[model samples]
Target chain A: MTSGDRGIRGVDSAADDFVARRRGQASAPAAADRPGWRPTRALSRAFVVIAVASALGVLLGRVDLVILALPFIIGTAVALRSRPTALPTVTLQLGTDVGAEGGDVHARMRVANPGEVPLSTAVLRAGVSPWVRLRQGHGTYAASVGAEMGNSIVVAGRAMRWGAHFFGPVLADTYACDNLFHYETLPAEAKRVRTYPVGEPFSADEAMPRASGLGGTHRSRRPGEGGELAGVRPYQPGDRLRRIDWRVSMRARELYVNHTLSDRDAEVVLLLDVGVDAGTSGGVDGKASVLDTAVRATAAIAEHYLHRGDRVSCLEFGPRVRRLRPGTGRRHYLSTLEWLLGVRVADGVSSDTRLLRSGALPPNALVVMLTPLLDDSSLSALAGLARAGRFLVAVDTLPEHVRPEHDGVWSAHAERLWRLDRENAIGELREHGVPVVRWGGAGSLDQVLRDVTRMSASGKAMI
Target chain B: MNDSRLAQRYHQGRAWLRRTQPGAMAVRTSVYVTGFLAVVTAAAPAIGAARAAGFALVLPILPTVRPMKVWPTALIVTCVAVWALTGEHSYALAFLLGALLYTHHTSAAQAVTMRTDTYVTPEVVTGWARRTGLVLLAAAAASALVGLLPRLFGRTDAIAYGLAGLAAVVGLGGVLAWLVFRKL
Candidate 1:
C-alpha cells in the first residue's frame, strides 16, 4: 500500500474510533470521574522488597545490610511523599490547512498539566501517520511538567501524495514524581489537510477559435472596448467621446467613431476519462501510466485556459459522473483541482444527462476531452458531448511506453489485436471530424487549435 | 594541517556509521553489553552466593531494563553481596551496582523517550544525566544517614536494638497502610 492508504488503516482508524466515541457522549466526560491515579506494579514491587529485605536483615542480625537498603528507602520515601495528580489535557495543531504534494506539514502538540502535583517524568507520544514521509522532530518527548507548566512539542514531515491527509490526537503517557505512577490518554481526533496536485506551469500562445464571454484577451469579431481597429462609422450618442476620430469627421463633414473588435473570453470544457488505467504504475518520478498522464494533462490544460480568462468546466465519467459547472476566477480554479482530487475509477460506467445543472453547453464553447480510448464508455461519453452540437477535440493521453505485461505467443497475438482495435477507435473518431492528438508538455494543442479555428472561420465547423 | 585532516576523516567515519546503522539497534546492543559487564562485575564478590544471586537478578532485566522494578531487586541483591563479603573483601561490587543502576535507568528512559528512527540528542542526554544525578545524590544522603544511625546507637543492649528494629518495621508498615488506604 502507498503511504496515503497506510495512514487510512492505522492511526486514522484510531482517530475514527475516537471521533465516534466523542459523538456518542452527550456531554463532556468528567475527567475526575475517570480512572484515577493508582500505584504501578513497579511501586508495589519496591514496597515488597523494602519490607521483606528490612525484616530479613533484622532477623539475620545483619547490621551493615540495613545500610544497603538505603536506595529503596529513599525511593519509597519519594513515591509516598508525592501526591496523585489528575491527567493532563493535550491538543494537537497543524501549521497549515492546505499544502502541496511533496511539501512539509508542521505539527505542534500542547500538554497542559492542571493538577496540584508536578510530574518529574512526562513522556508524550504523538501518533503519526504513514503518509508523513521523511519525518522529523521527536514524536516522543520526555520532560518535566509542573502544575502551571505546559509544553509544546513540534514534529514535521513531507506529504507523499495529493489527497486529504490526516495527522493528530497525541497519546500522552506521563508519570508522577519518581516514576511511581503512569497515566495514559486515548488517541485524539485526526486533523485533515487538502493537498493539491502542484500543476506544472503551462504556456500556450495559440489564439482560441471562438470567444464567447464579454471581456477577455481574445479579440472577437464584434465591436466593443478594444485597441484593435475594425472600421470607422458615424458616431452614435452612446459611443464614448474618446473613440471619436476628429480627422475622419473633418474630412467627411460628420462625427465619426473608431470601432474595434471586442476582447472577449471563451468557455473551455474539459471532459476527463477515469474509467480504466492501462500499463504499469511507475510513480511521478518514473514513466507515468495512462491515468497519470490524463490527470496531469488535464491540470495543465485547465491552468492554460484559465490563465487566459476563459470560463473553465470539468466533467469526469468513470463509474460515476463528476462535474464542475462552468465558472471563472482563481477560486474556481482551486475548486476544479479540489474536485479532481476525488477522481478515481468506479466499478462500472454510468452516465447522467444533468452533467450541467445550468442546462446544455453553449454551442460556441470549445470542448476538449482527455482520454486513452482504452474503454468504450469514455468514447461514448465523448460522442454524447459532441452530439450536443459543441465543437470538440479529443487529446489521447496514452503513454508512449505502454506494452503487454504477459510474455507468450497468444499474449502477443492478443496485444496486437488490442492495439488494432484502439487504432480503429481513433480512426472512427477522426471520421466524425474530432481531431485526436498526443499530449506533449508545451504547445501540444497549438496546431489542432489553429486548424479548428480556420475550419470554424470558413463556416465548416464540426460538432 | 595533519590534525585537521584526521578530524575530517573521523567525521566522515562517524557519518558513515550514522547512515548505515539504525539508532535503536545500536542503543539496545550497547545497553545489553554494558549491562552484562556490570552484572558480571557486581557478581564478582564470590561464585556461589553473590554471583548466583547477581546472575539470577540481572538476567531478566537485561532485555528491558524496567528501571523501577529492576533497581529495587538489584539493591537487595547488592546488599546481600555486601553482607556476604564484608571484611578483607572487595567493596567494588556495591559501587559498581550503584553505577549500573544509574546507567540502566538512564539508558532505558532514553530508549523509551525516542522513536526508532530518531537519535538521542545531546540535550536529552544532558537531561537524563541530570535526573540520574539527582537520584544518586538522594541515595548517597540516605546511605550517610544509615552510617550515622549505627554510630549514634553504638554499644547498645540487644533488647534495645531489637526493640529499635521492631519499631522501624512497624513505623514503615503504618506509614504504608496510611498512604495506601486514606491518602490514596
Candidate 2:
C-alpha cells in the first residue's frame, strides 16, 4: 500500500491560518459600523446607452430610433430615483457551535436595513467547508426588508465527518428600488463549528495486570476491606464484629478476622502513535483508514478503561508530545477526545523521550499503545515503554482489508510483503514480552488483557 | 460501445450534478433559459428575421462562457448598432436589450455571492425575475409616453441649442451620480 503523499505541514499551516482568520473575524466590529453603497456597471451601461442612443436618434432625425432608446432613459431615471443614506447591516449566527458526526446545524443570517430607503431585494450566501454538507433547500435565501426593519434566513447543514469546520464570510447583495444601485458588503464574519469524533460502541471489562487507585471495579491482590476473603487473620482491637471468622476462631480456639482483597482502581496509560496515518480514509460511512482506526480505538479503549473507574492518561507522540495526565471522569474523556482531533503526523523523527522522562507511568499501571504498526518510530516507542519494565500491550489498528483490490495482482503481492514486514515487527514486540492484539472494536482487547493478567499472576508484567 | 460503461458514465454525471448543486435543477434551468431568451430577443430587432435565426446558434455557447463583465455593455452596443443600421423605431429592440442586461447583471451578482457548490433556490430566482419584470414594464410604459411626445428634430439652430443643453444636463447628472456613489 502507498503511504500518504500529502505533507501534514501544509494542512497544519492552512488550518492554523483559517483558525486565526476566524478569531480575527469574531472580534471584528459590526457590519453597520461602515456604510458604503456603490453603483454597478449595469447602471453605468444604462446611462451611457441612453445618452448616446438618444442623442444620435435626435441629431439624425430618426424618430423611431429615438423612441426605441427612451426605455433605457426611463430605466436609468427610475434606477437613480433613490438615494441610500446608510449601508445595511448583515450578521450571521449559528444555532449551535458544537455538533457530532452526521448531525445538522442551522445558521441564521439577519439583514437589517436601518436606512429610510429600504432594500427592494437582498440575496445572502454563506460559504461552508465541503465536510459540512448543506441540506436540501438550505443553500441560499431571498428576502426584502422594509425601512428600519430586519429579515433573517436559516441555512442548515450536516457535519459529514469529525473535526473543526467553518462556515464563512457570509456575503450579501442588496439592491435598491429598481435593481439598479447595489451594495455588496465587505466579507462578513465567519462561524466555527466543532464536530467531535464519533466512536463505535465498545464493550470490554477485561482485567488489568495491577490496580493502585483508591477506588475501582477490578479485584486487586492487595489486602483491604469490602471484597472477597483472602484469608483469616488474628482478630485485632479495631476489627468489626462482621469481619470475625467464627468457624476459624472456634477451630483455632482464638479470635480471628477475615482478610478481604478490595477491588481497586488502577492507572491506564494510552500511548497513541500519531507518527503516520497510512491508507485511504473513506470517512465515516466507508472503510476506516489506519488513523481512523487508531483514533477510534484510542477513544474506545479510553472509554472502556474510564468506565471501569480507572484513571486513563493519553500521550500522543509526534514532533511535539501532547499529554493528558492521568485523569478520570466524563469530562476528562471529552478533553481526551478533543486532544485526539489535533493529533497529526510530524515532519521529522520524534526524538522526544518526554513520555519516559516525565515518569508519568506509575508502578503496576497497564500501558496500551494504539498504532498502525506501519512505522518503525512508533514500534520503537512501544519497545521503549516495554523496556521500562511496564506492562504494555500493542493494539494494531491497521484495517484487515486495507489492500487495494483494483490495483491488480502485483499490488496484492506487494501487500503480502508489507504484511510480512508488519508481522515481523509484531513478533519483535512479542519476543520482548509485549503482547500484541488486533483492534476489533467491542472485544478487541479482551484476549490481550487476559494474557497480561496471567503474566502479572506470574510476576512477569510487574517486572 | 459497451452498455454498462455508458450507463455508468451517465450515472456519474448525474451524481456530479447532485454533488455540486443539490436540489437546484429547476432554478438553474430557468436561469439558462432566461439567458438564452434574452439573447434571442435582443438579436431579433438588430439582425432582422432571417439573420436573427442564425444568432440562435450562439445560445448554446453562453452557458459555457464565464459570465463576462463586458456582456451588458457589448449587448447594449449591439442594440445601438442595430438601430443605427435599420433606423427602425421599434421599442421591442430596446426592451430586448434591457432584459438581457437585467438578467446578465443578476446572474453575475448571484455567481459572485455564492460558491459553485451552492444551490440556487427558486425563491431567489423568482424574486429577481419579478423585480426585473416590473422594471421592464415601467420602462416600456415610459417609452410609450415618450413616443407620444412632439418631434423635436430639425435643421434649425434652436434645435441644435436644445440638443446641446440636453447633453450638458446629462453630463452634470453623470458627475453628481459618480460623487454620490463613491461615498462609503
Candidate 3:
C-alpha cells in the first residue's frame, strides 16, 4: 500500500485513457477545420517595402532604388510559390497520469503537417505548472516539418510535489512559403499528472483498545476457539472434542479443554487539522511544511493498519469537515492516498466539532488526530474527542525548524513567550489524558497505544 | 493619466525584453546594429540635417525596446533618399546598402514571428540563411543587368527612357494588384 506500489498499478491505465481521449478528439473534422493559413505582419511589411521602393524608382527614374527593390521582389515571389492549404495537427502525449513524488514524467509534443505543402518552420510554446520542471530549457521550440511529415518534441521532468499537476496548454503555429503564411492552432488542453505522497515505513506492536469485526489478525480478550491460548478449564457441553488437552486430561484423569482469545479486527480513524500550516515547502527533496508532515504520516499509518486487516477512515477538521467512510482492503488504501492530495490549509476559519458527538466516529475506534497545535480550535477539538471517551492520540505535526516571523524589537521575546505557552498547552493536554506525541516515523505510537490499551482494559475514565 | 499609461507600457516592454531568449536576442541585436550601420554609411556624405534625420529614424530599431514595425523600412528609405540626393551614384555603395537592407528585413521578419522565449532550432536558422543567400545572388545578377541597360542605350534618348519606365511601372502595378486580390 505504499505510494510507489499504488502508482505502478494505476499509472499505465490512467495515461492510456488520457491519450486515447485526446486522440479521439483530435481526429474530429471540427478540429481540422478550426485552423487556417493567414498572412503574417512580416509578409505585409515586405510587400509594402517592395511597393514603396518600386513606386519611387519608377517616378524618379533612379536605377539604384529599383536595385534595392529587386531582392524584396524575388524573396516575396519565391516565398509565395508554394502556399500551404492546410494546417498542422498538434497533440500532447503524456508518459503517465499517476506518479510518486520525485518520479520522472515524460511528455511528447507532436506537430504533424497534413498539407501537401511543406512547412518552412513551426514554433511551439507550452505552459507548465511550477511543480513540474521540464529538462529542455523553457517549453518553447522551433523545427521544420516536411510534406506530410511530423515532428515530436520530447519533454522530460520530475514531479516535484504531491498533487494533480498539468503538463501544458500547448500553443503551436506553422510557417510555410518561406515564412510568409502562418497557421496557429488553438491551445491544447493541459494534461493532468497526479503525484502521490511517499509514505514512510511504519508499524506498531501494541494491541488495539477494542476489536469489533468477526475475523482478523489482532487477538481479543474474550475467550474463544483461536490460536493464542488463554487457559485450561473443565470441558463444557458445547466445546469441540479437538480442543481437549490430552496431556492435562491424562494427568488429571478428567476431561479438560484449552481456552483461547478470539481474533478480531479494529477500526482506525485519521483526523487531520487543516486550520493552519507553517513553514515553507521546498518540494519533496527539501524541507517539509506542517501539512506535508501530517499528510505523509497519515498515509504511513493508514497503510500499516489497512495491511493488517483493520478498517481505516480519514476526516478533515477544518471549515469543510471532509470525511471518508471506514473501509478495508487495497482499494480503500488507494482511495485514502487520492484523498490526501486535496489537503490545504484554510486560515481564519473555525472548525466544526459537532462530528465528534454525531456518532460518525465509532466509540471503540482509535482516533489519531494530526495537528500542528498552533490554533486553539484544534486543541479544543482534541480535548472534546478525549472527553467523549474516544481513544485519541494527538500527533504534533509542526516542523521543528519552523519559527515565527520577526518584524519588531520585541518580536524575539514574543516568540519565546509563544513557545512557552504552546509547551504549557501540550502539558495541559497530557493532563487531560489525551496523549500528545511528536510524530517520529516508525514505532511512534507504540508506547502511547500500549498505555491506552491498558487504560481501556481497566475501564479507566479521563480526568 | 498619460504618464501612468506610458510607465505601464514601458514596464510591459521591459518584461518582454527580459523574457526574450538569448539566441533570439542575439539575432535582434544583429539586426539593430546592421540597420544602424547601413543608415550611417548611406548618410555619411549627406548634409547635417539628413544625417540627423536618418540617425533619429534608426533609434526605433534599438534592441532595448520592442522594434517599431515601420521604423526599419522608414530608416532604409530615408538613407537611400539621402544617398540619391547627394548626387553620387557609387554602384558598390548601393549594393552594400542593398545587402544590409535585405539582411535587416529578413531578420526582422524572423524575430517578430517568434515569441519572447522561443528556442530557435538550427534547422530554421540554416534554412533562412540559405534562402537569403540565394535571393541575394539573384538580386545581384538583376542589378548588373539594370546597370548595363542604361550604358547600352545611352542617356541621350530621354523621352524613350521615360516612356519605357512608365510602361514598366504600369506592368508592375498590374502584378501587385493580382497578388493582393488573390486568395491568401
lDDT of 3 by residue, A118-153 (tens): 887787766665677666657778788889999888
Please tell me what DockQ candidate 1 reaches. 0.18
Q: Give the residue spans of candidate 3 off by over 4 A.
A: A1-35, B1-22, B47-88
User: What tens-digit string does per-residue lDDT give for candidate 3 at B85-149?
Assistant: 77646565676777777777777767655655777777777887888889989888888888889
Q: Where is model 2 chain A poorest over a 10-residue stretch in terms of lDDT?
A: A4-13
lDDT of 1 by residue, A320-340 (tens): 567788888787888887776
Full candidate order by TM-score, most accurate first: 3, 2, 1
Query: Candidates' DockQ values?
Result: 0.18, 0.30, 0.43
Instruction: Judge candidate 1 at residue B112 and give its lDDT.
Output: 42
Model 1 / residue B34 / CA error / Å: 6.2
True contacts kept of each: 0.17, 0.24, 0.48
Give the Å error, residue A63, model 3: 1.3
Q: What is the interface RMSD, in angstroms, for predicted model 1?
A: 4.4
What TM-score, over all chains together, does every model reach?
Answer: 0.74, 0.84, 0.86
Score chain A of model 1 by TM-score against the reference chain A. Answer: 0.78
Give the clash count for each candidate: 1, 1, 0
Model 2 C-alpha lDDT per residue in residues A274-323, reported as the tens digit of each score: 77776766656656677677777778878888877889998876667778
Predicted model with the maximum TM-score: 3
Q: Residue B58 error for model 2, in Å?
A: 1.7
